[model samples]
Target chain A: MSELTLRPGRAFSMVERNLLIYRHTWPVLLAEIFEPMMYLLAFGVGIGVLVGNVPGLADTTVSFPRFVAPALLATAAMNGAMNETTFNMYAKLATEKTYQAILTTPMSSRAVALGEVTWALLRGTIVSTTFLVAVSLIGLTGTWTALLVVPAALLIGATFASLGLVVVTLLRSWQDTQLIQLVMLPMFLFSTTFFPLSVYPKPVQWLVEALPLYHSIELVRACFLGTGWRHALIAIAYLVVLGLAALLVAVRRLDRTLRT
Target chain B: MTTAPLIEARDLTKTYVTSEPYTAVKGIDFEVRPGEAFGVLGANGAGKSSTMRMIACVSPVTSGTLRILGMDAARDGERIRARLGVVPQDDTLDTELTVRENLLIYGRYFGIPWKALRERCDQLLAFSRLEDKGSQAVSTLSGGMRRRLTIARALINQPEILLLDEPTTGLDPQARHLLWERLFQLKEDGVTLLLTTHYMDEAEQLCDRLVVMDAGKIVAEGSPADLIERHSTREVLELRFAAHERQLMIDKCAGVTERVEVLPDRLVLYTGDGESTLAAVHALGVRPAGAFVRRSTLEDVFLTLTGRSLVE
Candidate 1:
């Protein structure tokens, strides 16, 4: 496939288009905040009562809410970005032909890919910030480094958004969409979100380490607990590399699909 | 108008690399001069949309050359597209947006300023006769209203060349005429128009010049009157008969007219003069059928060139 000669920042045109529609669809934005809050209430509060304090970084145990809060924040970032890229992007690309129409203009496929990822980042930031405020109010902040979660949420969002675009572009039938939920539910439940990696068998531990969500939770969890700087750097590098590769693949695939 | 062509193509081709590779356009050549309405007339799957998509700069040319507005289409697609307005065969309007907002948002894609686009948006709404429907959601609008809105959106950038593919394929006659009037006005204002349609009347009414395409190739090219005069006679005499009598009548009527097209239920006789031809048919002593004479049209030209009717 030929590479597109991308124009810098032209992707913002797509961002503006989404913002225009966002005027009437603010209710969807409201739902993003509450979805994670519901998880926090049930998993962090309800389950935390029985599970008690789990093992934490540096051999120190933290409160149950504090332990689960960062993981939930990372999940929120992933969900926020993935939701925008998967179903909504699919409708625009396959059903509504929005990208097909846009291609007639000066906009290239690269711009569309970058623009959607940027919008997903914005969405991820909004919901994660709200969650951060709620957890901080409940006295979950163990250190000032928890402020780093906002930028970390953006990284997590970007990574998932790019990866989701790659998947959505490859999606051929509506029935295949169930595959996304199948993968997401397992990753969310088993990515050390509610439990530690030590609880899993050695083979399962290696599998969880390979999953993207595990790295995301570890990165965000380190931010709140103020430890694990060396591991955090590795996690950040992993996400950054994965996000760039997915973005490249998404743009090339979109260019082939739209221009063909 | 400048003498130089606004768009030009030489041996342009488009082939799909599917499981079974299919070639949609077969090395055709054409040009659109400034301020003229040029058309490609063909039936479904004759490669008209593929040609339009290539000219619109959204589809890559498989081989050969296409240049729009003096820039190479392959190398300068973005620059050429920036100066062109395209109305695709399907209505790709954002159903989630209001009519005016759709125009505003589309204008932003061209990097138009918000204030200028708002003013232009109002003008476009009035121009397409959708002024009252500006704030309505796109999903609430009727088919004709949506088509007009799509046209309005295409005009947001004040494009020098307008490309429309099947601009009124499925519209009611009244809506089609209304759209024709709007397109005529745009031509009067000097925007070069390139459109494709299977409707011969639409080609005759809007196109200054056109090419007839069949099975990925151009069969004939000329003004509508020129094509009719070149390919068909001055008039056509139609005679309908009982199913069994049609085959017998074809042999009987062969020598009376210049050409005879045997349809399923009717025999279309092409002649220089319909009256003399009908008189000649009567002289043949076969009087057991219905008959009529009419002037030749682009439809007749299409039939003569392609050996098939435009609709089929």
Candidate 2:
């Protein structure tokens, strides 16, 4: 037989890898559009109908959707990242044994990990940007500051993509997916995704500040209304560290699992 | 073919620790020279798969030495693997991809350029008889088709030494023969192959040299011709009798040949002269319903050395 460490570029192209699932699941891709639309309708129209921009910040009044728009943009990015890193990843590694097939050639475990992570980031970024455009058409934000949400979304995606792989490696089977649902659902709910942390207990607020998703929410939220520099910087830092640390763990675990 | 040994394993052993600590492979020495099609014949749970996994670099050896292409399996596993092609027992193809895509992706994993990969994919597709199934998802393919595709995929990089782990275990006869023909071509092209199979006929047909593994140890090792010539007669005369009458023939044929082994419905005589053996049996007034003299085979050698009684 020919030599083994298959060159990874010959496997699935990054675009091909992530889009393979997306191309077949247009409905899921389109579902990303509805998230921002929901924020526009519920918070922008319904909640804005009552709150009427009374709380802090600028002197002028703004819509409620505008308030949640940034958060939703961040949410969409996180959601897109979550799906790719979790379900798609599980299917590839466990059910499909796609990585095994790749490794049979010259591709190492590192390439497989990096390929999937990079693919997730790309998919997450694409969805985040697509959501941004869709929301923009619906008039979510006016200033160019909202455009910054694109990269912010990608960072959020990258962080979770790697983190999700770490989770996947530990995950026993499809039956154990309840852990994914149970863990992520609460984090999404309590991480200030829907409501601001100021509404929580001061002690709880500090805890929220430590959460990666909370920082991402804050970064995207601030970016939506413009002037989100400091928190965005902090969120970027968290994502960078989270992404690298999770990637390192994932690579080590993959090396161990595939090597033996 | 190079004079250097393509694969060399010195005192290779693999042990597993569990509720039952078992020694899977107990310090066995193995070597396959270039252009040699070597086979490991074993029953189930014989540690054949474990040995192949180690050679493929997917499993780490517990102890002893293994060198592929003269590079240490422990240190240069990844490097050695790059020059080897492995067709695992399980069909681990990407079901999501077409036949062409599978070859392309696998070639790319080897870092082949896309342009070159495309050409190689076409050649492999045709080589595997998958030319018409280029766009077909692997899930939609038949077992034989999938097996062929896997072989083709393994060849995408033109490996020097091929490792086949029960390569045709579940294949139909026609598919198996077709695969064997392809493998024969590879061998003629000077590709060194390490194969594992339980089929004695397969070992006889494909291997230039073979080792019979029973419970992790090599019980017998030699070329098929050498093995049969050494352990058995030039020809095998078969005699069959009624279920209840087999013992009578066994009684009659005791000294008819070099040796006679009794079975439930048949008796096999290891002899130099089939016609004389048959005449001797007939002279005893015992008539067998069927009779034939065939060439000796590796199966007869296995039966001779390992005993035909149930191993399990």
Among all candidates shown, the one with the greatest DockQ: 1
Best of the candidates, lDDT? 1
The deviation in Å at residue B204 for candidate 2 is 1.4
Question: What lDDT tens digits, residue by residue, belong to model 2 across residues A157-184?
Answer: 8888888878878878898777888877
Of candidate 2 chain B, the 10-residue stretch with the lowest lDDT total is B303-312
Q: Which regions of candidate 1 deviate over 4 angstroms?
A: A1-7
Q: Which candidate leads in TM-score?
A: 1
Task: State each model's CA lDDT, in order.
Answer: 0.90, 0.79
State the RMSD for candidate 1: 2.6
TM-scores for all candidates? 0.98, 0.89
lDDT of 1 by residue, B234-291 (tens): 8999998777776777788887865889876678999888888888888997664799
